[model samples]
Target: MRYDFLIIGSGITGTMIARELSKYDAKTIVLEKENDAANHATSANSAIIHSGYDPDPGSLKAKLNVEGNLLYDVLEKELDIPLYNNGAFMVAHDKDEEGLLQRYYERAKTNGVPGVEILDQQQARALEKNLADDVTKVLNLPSTKVTYPWEVAIAALENAVDNGVSFAKNKQVVSITADNEGYTVKTEDGTTYHTRYVINAAGAYTEKIAKMIEKKVPYHITPRKGEYMILDRRVAGFIQRTLYPTPDEKGKGILMVPQYHGNILIGPNSEHQASLDDVSTSKGGLKIVKEGALKLAKNIPFHKNIRTFSGVRASSSHKDFYIKESLEHSGFIHVAGIDSPGLTAAPAIAKYVVDTIIRPKETLIDNKTFNPCRKAITLYDDMSAEEKSVAFQSDARYGNLVCKCERVTEGDIVRHIHRSVNADSVKAVKKRSRAGAGLCQGGYCEHQVIKILAREFGKTPLEINYFSDQSNILKNETKVKK
Candidate 1:
């Protein structure tokens, strides 16, 4: 089918861009290589709405970061997603680091990040009592927030789909040929897509996509790996807000962040990897995370560790977001190297691409039927007692709890499976409903989730996979009555 725009990758950047374009008279399609959105760096990162203090002043990252940070309030309301402005504390360990705090404060002021304050040790400890004794100063940023990155991507893409943008999953783009009309994108599955405009937001594979059009694209992507460890919800209130150490070249140092749902997360020591798909967490990396996190908050209960996972960032060699229409190809735009501040900069970048870049090139009109509101999945815990009784009466499956740790019901899993962007696998269900993401890590609810998925999709338990189709959980069928 011929489309006005084809977005490569279903990460936050691509999905957000698709959402922005859906507001106008454009036929857009988002092609995802994975089975679901945010399967790579989008789902696995620190999940923080940075207050735009870190990026160099006047860079694309800084401009978009601040603009996107301001949009979360409206986004959270419209998308019905969870976002907590729980604030942040950049702690200083000693006199030298205290100097760094002053420098960061100056940067924050220059970047137009509001409500930033330089606090001494007494003021810092007043906010977080568990801070290390050696911490002499702190940079208190009241605008820093936390969110589930994958959920945000899902909400945006789902809203876009609701507004008439088509979505295709597991379609890995192999090559693109520029034509007089536009570009013809060929996928690995022998299917071709014709589009008048192409936006390359393929996360780690963005540089590869750019090179697909121009052989010498003047930029490269390095997969910088960052490992993280999540503690159980029992450690939620231990450190109230996101806590950070002094800055370094790698990125934001180890942060002790509180998830919006009350879980505690730590680590993310920056380690650059040679491979784009290497998201495996190493033992040494976890150890370094533990040491680095404990240096900021000393009383964390390491025994409460629940899960460990890693993400590979799309670190650009250019050191800033590479967003611009290609000089080599007319209709091809590049949105690559969006790493650290990406999650926070996504919406603004999407708006910039659509309003500033594409609209001027083409005669596009507004899609009057566009609706920004998207209904979110209802969780058992978020409901009032009266609402719960009414909901359970309407759908008896709501009474059947699938994930006891997270209070996820069977109805929740079933709803996710049948949503706009259906949650097809165990991991997708976990991302959508938090079924297998608790302390047990699917040890208790995995089979139940697989059973629900199998029933919903008309498959057997053995046919269900974890994340990818190749990673099947059940190898073969056991004893079954005929």
Candidate 2:
């Protein structure tokens, strides 16, 4: 079928693009390779909304970081997702490193950031007491923040759909043929997409897609992997704010981050890779994460370590966000080379692409009836006693506590499934409903979650995911005579 726009890759970049198009009168569709949005690097990111502090001067990262940071307050309200502007602190360990931190603060000011401040060690200690007494200085980026990445991605896609954009899951595009009218995209499932525009937002494989075109874009992409460790919320008391250490030539060094989930996250050591599939965690990476956490976190206990995961960044050799379109083919655009503050830049980048690349003069009508607000997840604890009693009576599943670690009930799991929750992978469910992400880490709830998935998704017990490898929980099935 024909669509005005075909966005390949349902990561934050693609999702945001879809949202931008939804504001106009355009037929848009986002094609995701996985079962749902954000199953790739989007689901596994460190969830830091950068303050436009890093990146070299005069780079896209610097420009878009400022623009993207400005939209958080409005976007959070529209999407109904949790956006925590807890701010950040780049703590200097010694007197010698203090000057470097100040330089970063200056960069933020140069970029038109309003609240960037320089604090002495004593002032920093007043803000966060857990800092080591020997600390030299700290940079307070008050606009720094964190958010649930998956929530933002999903909400954007949903809002785009509400404003008229279709989402095709398991639609992995393999090849694109640009023609006089548009491009014909052939997916792995033999589905064909004939669209006026092609957006190559495919995160890791963006370079591969570029090579598919005859006039391939001049670009280079390298995978930079970052691994992280999540500390239990109980350990959050040890953290006064996001902690940081000195940086080297490679990238941002390991540090402690307070995630939106009310837990402390650390590590994410940057490792460059030649291929996208090379994303994996190693004991060496974990060692850096833990040791660095201890050094940066003056009071966080190591016993709080609960989980470890890694995400790969599509680093470009040019150190800038790459957005290119074919001079011969107007509709074919490459939103590649998106790294670092790409998450923060996503919304702004979407608007920029629509204005500069698409230039849909005909479809410039603003959506008058667009419902920007989405319903937040219902929390049982938030309801009053009478409300809980009524809710439990309406659906007994609401009272059935299935996941003890997170106080998740059967009703919560059902809502996730009915909402088209992405559960093809265990991580998908964890991101969607916090099912297996609690303290027990699925040790007590794995079987229960599998059973629910089997019943909801119409899969056999063995068909449900058991681990990251997509292994089934049920070892065997029995056939009995009636």
Off by over 4 Å in 2: 360-363, 420-425, 466-475, 478-482
Model 2 agreement with the true structure over 5-92: per-residue lDDT tens digits = 8999999999999988888777889988776787667777778788888877787788888889888778988888888888888878
The residue pairs in collision within model 1 are: none
Best by TM-score: 1
> Local distance difference test, per candidate?
0.90, 0.80
Candidate 2 Cα deviation (angstroms), residue 355: 1.9
Which digits, one per residue and each the tens of the lDDT, describe model 1 over residues 326-401? 9888989999899989999999999989878887888879999999999887886679999899888989999899
Q: For model 2, state the Cα shift of residue 245 in Å.
A: 2.2
Question: What is candidate 1's CA lDDT for residue 107?
Answer: 94
Clashes of each: 0, 1
